[model samples]
Target: MRRAFFYGWVIVATLFVVNFATHATGNMNLGLFVIPMSDEIGISRGLFGWLTTSRTLAAGLASIVIGRLVDRFGARILIPASALITGLGVIAIGSATNVVQLFVLFAVIGFGGLSPQGGGLLTSVPVAKWFVRKRGTAMAVTSMGLALGATTFVPVTQFLIGAVGWRRAWFYLGIISMTMIVPTALTFLRRQPEDMGLRPDGDADSRLGSGAAQRSEAADEAVWTLGTALSTRAFWMLTAALALGGFAAGGGVHRIPYWIDSGFDHDLVSLSISVHAASAATVMLAVGILLDRVPARFVAAGPFAGFSIAIVIMLSADSNTDMFASAVIWGMSAGTGIVSQPYLWASYFGRSFLGTIRGVTMPTILVATSLGAPAMGYVFDFRGSYDLAWQVVVAIYAAAFLIMVSVSPPRLGRPLAD
Candidate 1:
């Protein structure tokens, strides 16, 4: 049974690695390809920005549906299937001939690639389902995949883009994403601990009993229907905070190159972006450890503070050193923000309905990101700088900080009924 529990951890770890790869591949590739794709296709940066928007929009819309599917069917089917489709979409992007083709292809990729699987949603839900006492730690550890992917894959993709050109990089990434992520998911991921004749948190012999008995016991756990979650003040607060946070973060992602355009060497700019990934990954791991020992709300707040300060520094900085420092701060904060929210949902609501709730939450947050991306790009196109956008982001982060502080953890022992 202990070995079985260990296997569960292994499954989480595998998903973590895959999440890291997919995120790194998805995000970093865009920045690397921006110039080449734009030059080849004769589209403005603002127009090209829609590719990302499409991806986010598709992802946002699909997350809820995918969550419902995962709940009804299981991760064993949903995860691997999404991966395969995502890989095909990546290949499609590589093969795209025109802007329309790219747009349609990436919309498919977004559907396949963008849904909240791989690490945060995918691993967190299943892992949370398996372990209650250790849920925070598990989420933190698994979410580190995002950071790890950013850390490792950014530099690697940077090298690939430089060496093989962006098109080949997409092809290689597509194949690798499919081959690696799909098999690992198929072999390891299980929907619930009960499938293995165990109970959540290894309590097979405890008050919950085993198998059917544990399932019966778990039936009483808080199950918030969609209406109840929507009606709660806490839910709106969380949604607002996360949505603003996404706007700030997404705006920055869209505008990073523009920031670099302000007198820094392009390679140095890429290095700075890579630094953000590395910092995010490191901070995520540290925060994950800390989350295991501290109040999650406090852990969540730390990132907002760091992010706000980083924006201030970025606005003030004129040199590479300042930019690098800003990247570290922002990266760390962003990493924390990404990991903290899912845990927040689990703690505030209930894990049983997490996928569905996250599905609803995801669209709002992603739409903010999608709109922010192109809007920031347009700001740069018109104003020739990202100063105004950054100012707005700073304000948004401040609001997020306040909102996060206002969030009270839900009462843990009772089921919240609609």
Candidate 2:
């Protein structure tokens, strides 16, 4: 008989903790410290922005090597070590006295907090290894920690900054990071279910039969490697769609100023953001379920289309109601990419070599993501309004939609020797 409980759920729970803690420490809660830290340390707001950029760039650079490590040795060694590195880095930031120090510390956080072993591509790869048919549901559940972390930890960080001061606040966050992340990951994480005589989705061996079970344990479930995956047309198409969608999404990300500048009350704008976050969370699970049911290309196309529509609504919007409606759609659209991209990577390429494939694709996606908001900001600087930017963003989304829908899954094959 199948065990009453599968350790795969335990893996999910471990990753959930890792995601929650690393996200809070990595980027989400850093905004809470910007004003206080900047004022006290004598840095401009613009200079402070570079800290995030540094973190993102460092993570992108580290992904290639980390991805290979996760694929080889598994998350067991890397995740805890990443947590330890991130925790210490956060703690060290408490002592930073200059921009150089801050930049170095943020880069440390990037390497530790945002790598495949820690936050961004962290849970997806490990979860993909443990579950196939249930991969969507698994990713959805684990990713919920990100939203929850933002909700819970941002306020906590703000409170700590207020009560203990900014320096002490970093100390506390680091402590929490090390305490929560390292132990859970070390205790529960494993390479794959088969490592422990379990199968993906916790299916009994008898159900798979001998051949399917062997495939599940070996190359059948994971056939493509970095070289073969890179050789496919589908991989390039997906990367292009991801880049376009990221850039398009960035155009709308700074829409708060558009509403505020147009005379919407700050309270209304804040409420709209909440609406967006709620909608995004709901859509994540919805997208996950759809991934299990529909063709991934179709599932992936929905977000690009939804985002385009939301932007079109906002560009012509004249009132609070229109903005709120746009927020709902915008949030829903934002949710699909995070969950689906990783799922499609695994589903199309197979779980075995997912880390390496994701690693290679991550830098491109990260560059697109990092550039999106600033590019929109740049347009607004010259034009004085978001009209031109949003129009361009809508066009970008259209291209992404077409590219996404046209993508075909890659055929399974052995990877060539390096």
TM-score of candidate 1 relative to the true fold: 0.91
Q: For model 2, what is the C-alpha lDDT against the true structure?
A: 0.75
Reference-based lDDT, each prediction = 0.72, 0.75
TM-score of candidate 2 on Cα atoms, chains taken together: 0.84
* Alpha-carbon RMSD, each predicted model: 2.9, 4.1
Candidate No. with top TM-score: 1
Displacement of the residue 136 alpha carbon in candidate 1, Å? 1.5
Instruction: For each candidate, give its TM-score against the true structure.
Output: 0.91, 0.84
Question: Against the true structure, whose lDDT is highest?
Answer: 2
Candidate 1, residues 254-346: lDDT per residue as tens digits? 545666567777777777888887787777766766766777777786777887798888778889998899889878887787677677777
